[model samples]
Target: MAETKKYVRIKKASVDGVWYADKIGNVYEVDRENCVSILTKRGIRGLSSVLREDAELIVTEKRPAKVGERVLITVAAPIGKQAYETGDVFVAESLYDPFAKDIRVLGIPDFIDYNEYEVIVDNELKNGEADGMESTYVRKQSEGLDRVAKSLGYVELAKSSLKQNGFIGEVHTFDLLTECAERLREQAQTHKEKIERGYPEFSPVHKSAQARRDEIVEQAKADVERLRENNIRLRTFNISLEVNRKDRSVEAIAKRPKSNRAFYGIAKAAPSDCFNVHIGKAIALRRALGLGVPDEYLNAPQPAEVRVGDVVYGKYSEAYYQLWCEDEIGDVSYEVKIKEIVDGKYRYVGGGYDFIDDADLTIIDDSREGVVGE
Candidate 1:
């Protein structure tokens, strides 16, 4: 039988404004028009056009299902229960009390029944899956046995049969296992899918909601840390790479902002490609962070001697240096003077050793050194 089988569409006008319990045991006060639409849309057997008084008949299932729990589904023949026979064997799908008390039962093997199993539970069946209805149903709880829950398709068929035989009022759950690996796998798969889709929901019975939320928050925090650690930023505080469209000038401002936005680092020559823009940004950021940058770029040319204000825009320019993919996958190794270390790195802080004897440590004055005229 198809996993999703459509059965006869039962439309009862009298069912309008009737309070009926869905397959999940939830009672809905649906009007006649909506009731027919819902039942037909669900197309599951055992569905009834309940009235307001029947609303009180709605009972919530509390006990959970266990693996290998013996179930005697009182459905018609061809769906695990032999035709004209009363009971059939099936398995529970989940380890503990899942969202639903659906069970899976088998069908009569290698035989066809004159009557067909009605599609109920909205095609929720592996063979004879049923809802958590009580009354005349026997449940032998699992006694710590490695048993798998029955498929829903088979159980649905049986559930429909039970409804047909007048035993579809209230469903109950019994035989809950402590914990099952299969159930864990299901939850894990759901969790994984949600994460991949960026809609993670940690509502597993095994874990607390706070625990799930904490894990997600921690994971996100770790990711942000990783990005910040491995990546470099050139913001205005660090350095501002502003392109003046008025004069087509690219100004690189170091950490200390000026009232006039002094161009601490500017490239007078037009860059061949976009790489120079990045280079300019890096230079400005490195200067702002007090890295060991040449005095020429800082517009404050001083002796190339070990000093506090010297900056150097550092990068992995080695032949074997590969662009960093992630987690320092292809980082080039280099040693810098740690005299002006900041944030535990010499690249961002000005902690480098520059050996320049003061005797001849002199620099030519350039009026337009830092201010690159467009």
Candidate 2:
């Protein structure tokens, strides 16, 4: 059997005279033996041949799905007529009912265990995204009103289309479109109210990129608290992992209380990828803990082109965020939906849509980690 493995992300710049393809912020998957073959200018090379102290382990965890939310099947679970295959998506109807021994989904008659599927996006955590915006409460209200105005235009178009089509005996289609428009209007109102309630005065949106980056410094302090709760065996009381995002680079500062000495871990995302705070924290923690970094982080495979459904990091004008590419726009751009912080996690949400130039996007997914070459 193949050895179970994990991913590692690089955190530092390459040194002179080194022959390995060690670049900052690239992530690579490695086997239990800490080995991965990477594609380099010199052809494929073993990542283990170089020093691994510059990379840190990446922990991938799945957040639980809630009732009425969407989930993606990660494993095949065939049960009579309600058979589910991997890569399938369905809406969950109910959560684990101790009486049923599984969870229920809309179309499936059978129940599935929690391990079989993962939440597509946690809707509850989506509200935090407004916290990332730099706009004030009044500006947010104006944006919400702008969406309502756009929705009104769409509703008018639907009505005009219905008027033209109703005379042609396509009444059912027109009715459905009209109904959808009504729902869109209702949703817009609801969104406006939600944003009003979640204004900057109450939730406090960041004023600048650096202001947002400063939160990562505090995140290190919080991470220490989290480590104490989960990693009881690890010594966390003396350790602090502070992270800061500057442009495409995320820096982590690890230190002990009142100490002049501190260790730093820095991860710079590639020009085509978004900066990730999680990667920065991992690298910084590893360096602070006096542990050797993993090999794969320095030599992971990178995507050369964007594809539909790819998760990319890029900026839409002044707002920096992740996007889910929905379709190709012309030859050099894509229609994308912004990934929002839904329930404290990043998810591809509805309504936040725009076109992004391919030149401005960076592919961030790292599933192709263990492959030997391009």
Candidate 3:
């Protein structure tokens, strides 16, 4: 069956009017003069600037928003207005004014165009047009009117203060300043807590010091184990040449190959072309030799009897070996041992020697059916 994708429903606000929301609910107001289209048609840049300012207002000052959190905007006046006398919730309704036509509701991703709004407001104030909305009256019920008045008065006072202090007469500036102040306070509190806890300097390195030490130790152990497992042996022989000075005669002596000579155990060596040896092969050899064997191998039971021609199998590497059985048979099963061990590979070698099938090989200390012994 195919999987289905999930979707979430998000509320949209009109771009035509001032969006306002109270504890009761949200409301939209249509002011043709301040509609999104007018701002866009006159210059999309201007509209973008307004949106940026509004977003900063919501984030830095009015109500700080979490990242990706939904922000609701309404066209009605701010909360705590006189029009809310009956404590009636503000609801969006059609405007009776003809000038309010052609307003639209738009849904946009949060934080989009925030910087643009700042720029537009900044440019407008620089051109001495920041007071354009001073005479704009938003129609509402008595309580709503009172709330709007209060909100507007607050906005005016804020603007006047900025102007007197030589700050830009822009809504975004006021909102951003408020936001900066709040952020500064939060940071100050956080710093104080860290200092009280005896942490004069707070950094990622200090926080993860212990964890980093543990990680390094673990890595070192892994590297050592890897090196030990990869170790192999190399075989070297000494050739002797005899010379008789008086007779001017020379003789060369060659050494016979012994059973032990066949086994070249070294820390590292390339596999011979006659036999393929891989990392798995090296591991299996170590296990068969029982040299430096791990505890897991030490706990395992030893074979009842390992004949010359018997086949030795490694469970982990899936490698198989057949030993030459006798001396008369130059390549007797017990004498000639063929070992196959390689990383990421399995090998099979059997010639009348006791051997287990690949499929039956397992780590558990249990025997499978049809084996020579239980």
Candidate 4:
């Protein structure tokens, strides 16, 4: 009996202002046969009038190539006495890897590198075939076992090499190696037995295997979460590289435009001899985004003594946000001179300069060469 497949082409835009989700005249595959409306993967749904019956059924499936499928080699690889050239088509007999990138095919003495191959056709399901989904699950289980067996093979190879090159270590070291070798052999035998006894259950019943599967899933989720965070950071810190060149000094400015017709401006300056435009831009951008600057950016050793014309920063005031005391604000810069010295404290000649301790000031730029500190 011919299969009855349903296809749809959207004829009108959605009323919910989600036009981008589905265009006015794009075809899509639907699971239902006779429905008045359909919800697509893009989240578009409406009345029957919004859809037009499409004659061509689109079967879009994204999955790794499986065994028993026809594939065309895109890359030429030499194996044994003969070479498999590009454009050679073959039916894969067995998958040697989880991704189906390495396979064993008929008429090939060695495993073929199937990574550089295009799928000619997928294996068709027969009338009395075992459930396709169930077969796929079993195949995946077998592939995982194959991987474990391959790893054990490598361990056995290493053990053989270690025994061949007689150990120069003490007696206990040799004993340890022997114990590891025995364990590896036992593991290999166990994996071989499991492969012979085909996987019948939907999921692994053993606690150790289930825990390992959960660990893999959790690790994958962590990797995806980290990538998402990194993408956000990249978008937030989008910066352009430019340098303002002034005689003996270079300045890097970072600008971030806000929706309120204003922008965040941050600038950093360095002597032309020691300036790296890229690092300067990164530092300025981080500061503009209120992020922590790397320690390597502040590489120069700060001077022990404060001199005249030296630019300095002071912990001027404490900030309070929402009635709660926040961090200390240190953006205010000051340049002062010693006007008088009393009670082992120095008073400077500047705006509101008073008897301030030396520890309260941090010298940031010491450029003036001949000026003396009094």
Candidate 5:
């Protein structure tokens, strides 16, 4: 069998000088100056230390680093083919030696547990030890300063909350409370002025009582005059004359016609003979005339008696006749009802009328004909 190859995941070392972490804890940095082909031939182990400080280590899985903690190094590179060919080192969790100070050979703890306290390499603690046992006391003093800073921050935040809430509450209460005080002051002043002037406050009940007394006096006087007028007109007799239109004579004993109801008004027909007769009013006139058929319909053109295409005209005025005709044969001139009048032009609907028989109907154009009549 052929030699089995180990499979390793790969990742880019950097993007635009920014570093990323890979599966393993070891970090690597990329240099834009070196190409992949050059790095593969020359190898990357020697260059690893120079770039180590700039490399950022990112732990994707729950490995050594906590959820939000980050490593101080730069970019991470993948393992396997490209990395191997490029002479890039593959990192495993066990291989990191973090305790070693030299970047050339580093070591890490055997295993890291999350949320557990572990002692990191304290370079400052090591440097301070040279100053003797007094250096320990200085370290404790530095911790006290940190606590003071945190406490001051919380106090300042509380003061800001008090000022912001106090200002808003004061402004709202002052505006509404001041307005109520001014209204009360005005009412007190008005009451004092009314008392000094010796004038009673105007009230509707007092005015209504006085008005009722005056109304009763006027009503008594009107009742006395009304009785006197009733006695005078009651004795007066009214003589009305009924004229017989056929005989052109008046009847002495004739009572008023059922159609004529005006008593005191002059007996005269409507001044304007032209009147707008609605359908209901025309029906009433037909009943009074004892005409079994409606006069409006009787005057209307008969569709059966008239030919399919016949011309008829309306004598609206003595000088003009509005033309009505059919445009086609087998077309009847049905009932023409006036629907509306707009701008002195009467619009009517002709029922059962055909336009196919007569295409040309004479429309009287007086202006074009040069007629003498106005």
Candidate 6:
């Protein structure tokens, strides 16, 4: 078996100052026998003759990274022939041998992906993205919101296209993102309320570990009292998990006086304690913008029909969109919807038809007052 090793990205460089290739990819080869290769140390299979602190690419490029004129370019290269996934950022430094037919290009890959960068941008973690999100800590919280707001590849592109096409910032959406954000806030509020009601472990998704914070607090007080009565100075008390030998049942246990912050940080919370963070964020943003949630959103939204004679707009548009038929296609794919030209150049999908089946517009669903002419 050819040892099945896969790398999402690979950095190739000329080990002996002999590698060269084009910036696009596919490096050049000089002196076939003594072609570009990575230097070998005593035991390390991965040794580089490259100039930077990056892993050595086995091939050099025309855009060589010389000692003084180091240039950087971003490109994709698969190591062990692994296919590239979305959001992979690869940068390269190479030296081209213009004198001869071959130029040694040192490839440098910074292999940073969204998930591995340790920031949660998926719609799932929007509200509480801060609990453990790195971008929030590294940058400002507003930047973090913007990052997650346009986190999806399509979402980012749609925003960029709307802005580029002179659409107002508020209308920079192909779907009812604002309405969805409000919906997220409502969801977050519910989640937050449940947590406040001593049920931090509650979640619509994921199995929740029941919250025993109050019980823990009471137990902590009793523990401190017991220690005081026993003539032991209760310096600090902390809660921990212990396995019972009687029935092999694992349960939380309260112990004493570990550190100054023990009692405060000792309470039991939901697992990961980061549920509904994004929803909270969405809610806050909507309130800041003077937006309110629909009354129906308080409970389940009633099914509404999209019909003819209604005016609508594309997810990202300033021109009002017009509908095609007087019939109802309340739920259908956006691709099937006919395009009504608002202006000579500006066109939009016929309105009144929901794009829930659309790969992009499903984020909005039926929230907000969107079924009628706007």
Model 4 bad stretches (over 4 Å): 1-130, 168-174, 201-374
Error of 1 at 237 (Å): 15
Q: Which is superior by TM-score, 3 or 6?
A: 3
Clashes of each: 46, 8, 37, 0, 21, 37
The best candidate by lDDT is 2
In terms of lDDT, model 3 sits at 0.27
Across residues 40-91, which tens digit of lDDT does each residue of candidate 3 receive? 1112322211221121111111222232122233213323332322112221
| lDDT per residue as tens, model 2, 1-374 | 22223344444544444443455545444444322322222225544433333344432324565654455565556676666675455555455667443567544667887766655532111111234342444454566467556756765786687677665367665675565566556656765776666543544232232333333334443653565354444533355444443444545555554677666666666665444444445555656556554433333324444433445555443223224344543344333433443343334435444343224655554222222431
TM-score of decoy 6: 0.15
Task: Sort the predicted structures by lDDT, highest score first.
Answer: 2, 4, 1, 6, 5, 3
Q: What is the TM-score of each candidate against the true structure?
A: 0.16, 0.28, 0.17, 0.19, 0.15, 0.15
Which ranges of candidate 6 are over 4 A from the true structure? Answer: 1-110, 113-213, 232-374
For 208-243, candidate 5 gives per-residue lDDT tens digits of 222332333233334424433543466332233343
State residue 336's C-alpha deviation in candidate 5, in Å.
Answer: 88
Report lDDT (Cα) of residue 252, candidate 3: 30
Write model 4 residue lDDT over 301-368, tens digit each, in one string. Answer: 22445444444445443432223444455354454544445565555657444344633765544443
Local accuracy by lDDT, each model: 0.32, 0.47, 0.27, 0.44, 0.28, 0.28
Q: Which candidate do you rate higher for lDDT, 1 or 3? A: 1
Across 1-374, the per-residue lDDT of candidate 6 in tens digits comes to 21111111123332223232122232211121111121223123333222111121222223222221212222333345454433232221122234322122212233322122111111112112123333322333344334333333333465567778877556534454443344334444543444345312332231111122222223334443453344334433343433222232223333445434322111111232211211222222223223452211111111223222222223522222225444444433332232332322223354333333431321122111232431
Q: What is the per-residue lDDT of model 1 for residues 1-374, given as tens digits with 9 covering 90 to 100?
A: 22322222121222233333223233232223221022222234544343211222111112333443433333344545554342223334332224334433333343322132222222111111122211101121221121223333334455566678876553541112212334534544544444345411331112222233233323333443433344345333433457542242456554433345443655432322111222344444444344553222222112232223222323344332444333444544332322342443333233333223211212111111232230
Q: Which one wins by TM-score: 5 or 6?
A: 5
